[model samples]
Target chain A: NTSELASHELASHELASHDRTTFNPTTEHLTFAARVAWRNAARCVGRGYWPALAVRDLRHISEPQQVFRELQRHLRQAWNGGRIRSTISVFGPGVRILNDQLIRYAGYPDGLGDPQNRRLTAELTALGWSPPVQRSDFDVLPVAIETGGRTQLFEWQADDVQEVAIVHPEVGDLGLRWHALPVISNMELRFAGLTYACAPFNGWYMETEIGARNLADQGRYDRLPELAQRLGLDTARERSLWRDRALVELNRAVLHSFDAAGVRLDDHHSLTRQFVAFEERERAAGRRVNGQWDWLIPPLSPATTPVWARSYREDRELTPGFFHSRRSAF
Target chain B: NTSELASHELASHELASHDRTTFNPTTEHLTFAARVAWRNAARCVGRGYWPALAVRDLRHISEPQQVFRELQRHLRQAWNGGRIRSTISVFGPGVRILNDQLIRYAGYPDGLGDPQNRRLTAELTALGWSPPVQRSDFDVLPVAIETGGRTQLFEWQADDVQEVAIVHPEVGDLGLRWHALPVISNMELRFAGLTYACAPFNGWYMETEIGARNLADQGRYDRLPELAQRLGLDTARERSLWRDRALVELNRAVLHSFDAAGVRLDDHHSLTRQFVAFEERERAAGRRVNGQWDWLIPPLSPATTPVWARSYREDRELTPGFFHSRRSAF
Candidate 1:
């Protein structure tokens, strides 16, 4: 039964087995738990697809090198020739991934690449990972995994990853691109009184996540001012709304590029609508949908979305959920 | 000293005076209290000008007709011939204003103008107020004041009110205009354990309040879709970013119109910068700035502003503040 087991009962089982690290579940239960965890993710806007998550039970693999190999395989399989499928690869306890995400761009000290990854890049560099001769903005960072007090580094072949080169429908090319699959590696999945610390999971990209936030945010790519300049907008005046205009254009480019590449990506409008429908379905099934209002609303033109007007239960104590790992990469 | 007094101590003074309705303070205390109330308004983004607020002490005026006359004068004086001044006119206790705002457009059953005021419009209509034969969208509603259980309706002369007709910088007239002053009449101003029930306060417009919310919200004017059609934008595709583009243009129109009309208006950028400076100054003075982040961030291109990155104390129990009246108009 996939029901709540008392923590004390689980503790007694751990004592009987003499192995606190191992808490095994049936394959069916593990898959169902992973799906339920996705459904319970309050900050995710794509909960409608939680039922479709394919759970890979790789708990038998404890070696660092083997776990890294499975991660590479997870990337390629999840890519699925760009009809990207939501997937998760679960490893045993004591298996730790040092990257926040399975795939992220390396950031240099001189600020050439993604600034969000600067600390992680430095950590990987200190751990004896070598960079390419020429560094670019989209250089993929090497995957680092630790198991049984030993750590190892692994790199993916270019064919394993899928990336969309952003080009606006109206403004041909501004030379921007983002990875298709976003496998969050640093979250622990808790289910039935047990924690799976290396359950790297992913869904398809939401266009605004890449456009309105990743590239458009002042701290990240900080591309709006440059994009405004390229578009010959009046950047000197805030009344001109040059930043808003540039944001829209940049988001448009991301959507157009994803569509051209046939990579599955959701625009904010469709995704929010889907989220509302999911909310309704959960309510119909006698389940309360908990959500953070700020996270649920899209960053661009938030008031236009249905979620902007709707309020959900802000505080929830849900079990069988994905939570931030105690051991964070940064 | 304008320090916090015990509520029981004020109650004891009320018993000794045999007048519970009146709590008189020095003129200087009243002015300072009004200024501090503006500063402590957590939702306000223009608190940088809190010190410059012109407080008019009309506490002695308690008759209904006399209150109406003073309100009319407050509007004209605060308008200041387009260079609007932040002003407040305080009336004694037991005085109630039926209108939420001193100047707001009436909404007809056919949804002609300001659906937010529909209930108030019906209430006023029932109270023997007459609508114009040609009820245009810009028709101002009559102000209703109640004192001694006698409610009187008063209308402002056309010269007393200042309105800005919205026109775009590039695109010409769209037949949209808004009143210059926003004097919130229903909220109570409390200071030193006494409540001023009819203290109307005025502040100049933030263009986003007009452009992004009042006109752009779906339940409000919903002018964006029509504006987008008129601007020749493709509305079929959500990825075209039609809403974002239209929002920017509408905000641009508001900014351009106010500047052209010589009206005092704050664009979101300059106002947010001013808010950040106010926050710093408050910190330097050893006072925590309490703020609601949702209200502080402008509706248009919010992440482009400095307030987007800052955090503030969300909860506080401060005296000498303006609060929503328990006796609401609607």
Candidate 2:
């Protein structure tokens, strides 16, 4: 128990660069550390199920092609016929995945698709990755993996990716959709003083992440104005609250569509409640739950959620955790 | 210019408690300090009009009875026939207002009114302040002031307090209403090594303050459930977004009613834009605007505002500002 406590205390601090050479954790230790890392992810509201995370240790495979193949396997396995599984694929040092996420739609030059991915889309285009002859907003980008001073692009076979078409129960179709899996590939997984530069990890999507932010944010999809127009709401006056109505409907669509599609997507309300449960479980286990309150509270009707009323200690030093990478593979 | 720079620099730090005894400021200095304190208030989104703030130097008054009378005068002058004015009355040390605000609705024994004022209402009742013969949700509370180890209650004359009946343009009447003037009475104004224990400040209402929070917050009036029911929204399903729709309608009602009543009320959109202008003006004058982001963004559709995209330094160390008092008067 004392040794476990000491290990946890050590993991709570960022290991200096010199510690990396001396640290050599066993495969079991690596797996447990990875799970603890997921547990330590402060910004994730879906961390209630962190203990059930499947950490695929691909640290032995150093070749880019092998890494790409494993990543493809990861996508298919995690998809699990729409019943999405929480997963992470940890690769060895010097292996980097350029894509911010395993699957992201291309953002075209003319302000089409996800504007957040415009720079990355342009970069992929420069790397000899050809776009489809007919450009669409939903063109999935190729995963660019870098290894041994060389980089290669790998495309996910169409069958590997699953996307849900957003449809409101009351408002009907508005032709909006988002990918099922959200495997974040850019962040480094640091545990036991060792860093995995290519550790792509994911849980199922929270509806608000897609609805209120990704689609509704002005800088992202910028969908509210169009949604408002479609709903025949008055956009002339801010007091009319056309944007607020559109946002709620959009979120409703995301939740309803995901449910109808039988995909494992979490609604903000249910997810926030689970987060509260997660906090209680952590407290019972004698562990402090550090969280960034801004990230914890959903963007939609935030005050309705319990997280809005509570303050959180935003301690980012917790390890066996994911961190921003020092450099991009691109 | 050098002396002015020195004075500005000196005003930026919290003067130690020891300095309070030695501090002696002229009326002109006190007036300027009050305005600057408003400008430096981190949580006030309406502070774009800080320069126009009328500071009444009632600092000479020490009696509780006279303080109560002056506060009533402050309320009426601030009302200005529904075209509210930003005003602050600075009373000298040992003068403390027990009420959190100059005007707030009382919460009865049965949870009919504002629950936030329940404890205060009970305390006032214990001090011999009588409730109305017929209890209502919008009963204006009597002001309690403490001076020289004695507490006294003062009631505002009927015409002095201007209240707007909240009625939606489309949703029509739900029988909700709020007072026009928001005179915060409890906070201590710290400036020039001095603390004004009873400085009550007034600003016009921002519709969201009444609609999205005071009425809609679960701990307050909790109007969303009733409003949602009135609007015939599906309450059983979270995906129906009943609370969100009700919130927007409630906010719309507040804005529409205030406009119809010819009361000065700032909508979130316009106020946030003004806040941006305030930030620009402060920056141009070589001053960093410190703000609490949570307080700055409106609770309703927060991401829709310009303030949502931005981050603010939440420095509480800034002086010539309002601070939470060490102890409550009650």
Candidate 3:
């Protein structure tokens, strides 16, 4: 039924030009060694591995259009311009799917990642899922890290400075508008903010996310607050209390989080540290002793001066030593 | 090199007795009613399904201690504890895992569901796999849902209250203490003041993380000043605002969760509808106009105040005709 290039063609590809005997079937255990694999198939066959197995060309099986669309979607997501990655791994195996990238994902029959909803354990067991297993797999999710991937550069020169809005959390809604910061860099990785750049691009383009990370790690942000010491970074002042104000502002954002889980922008990794530090600083600033602790608790504060349920911006700050001890009583 | 009786005995246990001798060596396929199986001995070889798959049976694998300890730890994780159910189908073409519990999940090789992660695509092709190329040869994933697997219930006999501390988002180091309200019904699930439940008795449990969801679905929350109606909930008249006050006082603890995704208290069913409503109330309140905009868009009264960001207090009662479209912009 099919054209044969001669039985020797098959032997030539595998063995030398030796004698050509058709075949015999055999069963043998096989070893596995691959960076990635799909084990779901093994379960159905009722077997594990079969070494010296046959291989087929899977590329032929795919419908071309489907593959193209998928790649497009992945690209849009990887770069936050089009599809913004929102889901954080809070339920089910705690997958950190930033940019929707998968490092290690095995076939999970049902979605167990819902923080609010979960699968019944009994049902899953009947489905052949043996959880509480100690096998973990991972794959490096791709990011615009200059250290690992190559960068593309963009040359879009603007005619004038553009202003963007910064909506403050407490001021109600009016966001302060400021000129876009400049992105001035000669890095090849930045192709008009695609490589490792997010929205606020002025003109400075670095190599990658790792590149930005390296700068921050190398004291870039540390040096930044000092540059604005007079502008707003001055922590020593009380009236314009720059330090407290900045700390307070940062705290406000966190205060604005959903639940105590602190659901804020995942991209803002350094946010937690600042929030924690400000809190520590506040506690360090004791409440001059005779602060109103009784009235500030629940119903007392509700009627007098309203306290937002989601915030820690209370009327007073207790010394850490005092707070640690007195909190239970309060 | 092999023992006759031992091999036959093992094979016999797997197959029917009379069928063993009657099993033709030349037979290429086997049938059980409508269930036709690929008759190749290939299953007898390879990694061996037992080696590649982890079943809780404990007998099929080794180091029972390792398995037990791991399960003990993983069960506490939100993902493992939360999983409701999953089903895996290992087709000849590929492995399919269908998880349909709280959220939906179906994973095959990346190429199956996701186009980008084609690790399975390559591996499958190499394994000479295809989608039913021939009906005679077969495949399938070996997974099924089981009974008596797991169900969590948080049964409380009385309103035995407890306490939990939360770090205020803005307040920093000085922490806030919220009383844990343990009313089994609407009190904790609908209103607030629910830290982790103390279970039926005083039993120790493990943990995991979750998010805010039930708050909205249950309709317990509303926009800011609107949510303030909580103040009106008190039968204790001295303070008409006691309800709102109580919510804030126990805000952290009130919103404390009993997520099914993590290690659950064996005694709690963790009602979904009510559980999600409280979180939603806060979210709904947050969605309302930002508090500062009250000046631009004044609330029902100059004194209504913006409780939208904090607790949902109902103080705004704007007349339907009170649109201020003609007002000058501030």
Candidate 4:
């Protein structure tokens, strides 16, 4: 009885009947929605460049192998070797893709018992992803793709990824490198009341996101003590402000390296200015600019920014933007 | 009928009869209590050096003129030509001393006609206390003392005060100065249930108390914007984080100048470490260490300190510590 009507005809009839409550977007509508979502990203300091966002619509592709291939291409194109481009790849809706990001640095267990992402590393190993020949801090993680109710792994090509060399002369080949594209993959795209579960977006890195939190935070890389020692700061006492001095130097190196390598990275200072301008522009355009104070303010030297002095309203509207997906029990 | 008994005998009888409820202290008891009160000051990071505190018992001297003289002496001795010492002069109980601190900078009306403490400065001027020969950012206000219910003015001698030269090369001779002694005169001292309303206490400078709040707070000196400009930070946009950069430099100058002048000033980092050590010692001695986390943490680089990582209980115990006096309407 169901085979009497075509799938497209049935979908169109359902959409027409529930037009007020739900939406089924075409490829063109998805592309436009992605651009608007970038503009609506409240916490982003780089919204002024929303017009330059390159959104790839791949809504028809549902195979895990094909999705993996497209993701690899997206990363390579976005990396662009020291000239990172802001891009996003839209996958078919309702596909459950596992892993926070298509690309992440693998954190292995060092046997000596340092804090590492043992669970994640183990999971990747079980899924047949090989670790780098030499275990290093900056090893790239394999992509995990789930489609047709099945999970598959894909290896990232090393050459396609771009990394800037940290500028500290004393660091001595510890190989401090950050992958150029910061693609947030796990977030769901909601547009016109329809959810695209597998859309991933990328933006150029903000230096403090790497220097202040990723490396400086005690939980992640925790490089402050080592950097302080290398910089000849007195680590014996906190009164010397060794950690603060080290943090400033680390942030400086991140900015310098990115700039020297011609990578499109924004320093917190520059980003703050850009955000202020964006706010003004949005206001002039008769749009209410929403932001989260904590997210808008960079972690390093926060009070130095104008955002710290002002409060922002949290906008919870869920259209033409990305939303965090609920975690699966698995 | 009341004149039949001697005052000391009557006070002793009342104390002996009501031992569990209310109690009074002799001059000897007051001196010891003052030392203990300082040790119990929750907000103070320099309590480890409480043994070195100089307590001047002036409770017997209730005359306004005598109190003023003692205050002058306290300031001079505490300044000690940049080798600052912690000192306190106890005034008689229930005496009304009007100012929060013995020393505060005068705020003047600019061309913008903004609300300044012009009334206070004018009142002091009328009382024959001269303003600085040249009006400057850190001009010290004349001391106001009230004893026997009569208010009197006492001019602070410029020679006794020491000022640190700011490190920024471009900020030439802005005449930035802070009175060497931070004598908190208006707070009440409670020991063994008796209240001394006019007890004033001083501590060695914590640089953040000067650089971070006194100089940087918007309502007070509000010097960050000017300092940022002088430091050659781009203030054309909010994102430049000029304020943060300027604040760091300002703190640096304070520490450097204090060190150069042989002043007993402690930077927040050193103070935090010292506080942590103090807490450990108190714990080992079975004394509960009470503190307010907000007050204990330095305004600048707060999270960099270990104090920021932990919580402290607000001790509600009234006795054996200093307490904030209720503000008088007049």
Number of the top candidate by DockQ?
2
TM-scores of the models, in the given order? Answer: 0.92, 0.93, 0.18, 0.68
Q: In candidate 2, what are the lDDT values of residues A1-330, reduced to their tens digit?
A: 466556555544434323677766656566668878888888888888976788898888879889988998999899998899998988877888889999999999898788899988888888879989898878899988888777788888988789989887877887889999999989988865578888999889988889998999999998999999989998998767788889988988898898899999887777898899999989987889979887888888788787888888866878878998768743
Per model, the share of native interface contacts recovered reads 0.62, 0.65, 0.00, 0.12
Greater DockQ among 2 and 3 belongs to: 2
Candidate 3 residue-wise lDDT, B174-237, digit = tens: 1222222111110000001111111000111111001011111112121123233433343343
Over all chains combined, what TM-score does candidate 3 have?
Answer: 0.18
Q: Rank the models by DockQ, top first.
A: 2, 1, 4, 3
True contacts reproduced, candidate 2: 0.65
Write the residue-wise lDDT of candidate 1 on B1-330 in tens digits: 223334334533543565435646766667877888888998999999987899999889888888888988898899888889999999876789989899999988898988888888898898888999999887899998987787788888898778999998888998999999999998888866778889999999999999998889988888999999988998999877788889889998999999999999999889999999999988886788979887888877677789877876665457578888777855
CA deviation > 4 Å runs, candidate 1: A1-23, B1-23
Better of 2 and 3 by lDDT: 2
Error of 3 at B294 (Å): 39
Q: What's the lDDT for candidate 1?
A: 0.85
lDDT of 3 by residue, A242-271 (tens): 322232232222223211222222111122
User: In terms of docking quality, how is candidate 3 classified?
Assistant: incorrect
Error of 1 at A66 (Å): 1.6
Candidate 4 per-residue C-alpha lDDT over A144-205 given as tens digits, one digit per residue, 9 for 90 to 100: 77766767887777775677777753454334777677888888887656878888888898
Q: Say which docking band candidate 4 falls in.
A: incorrect
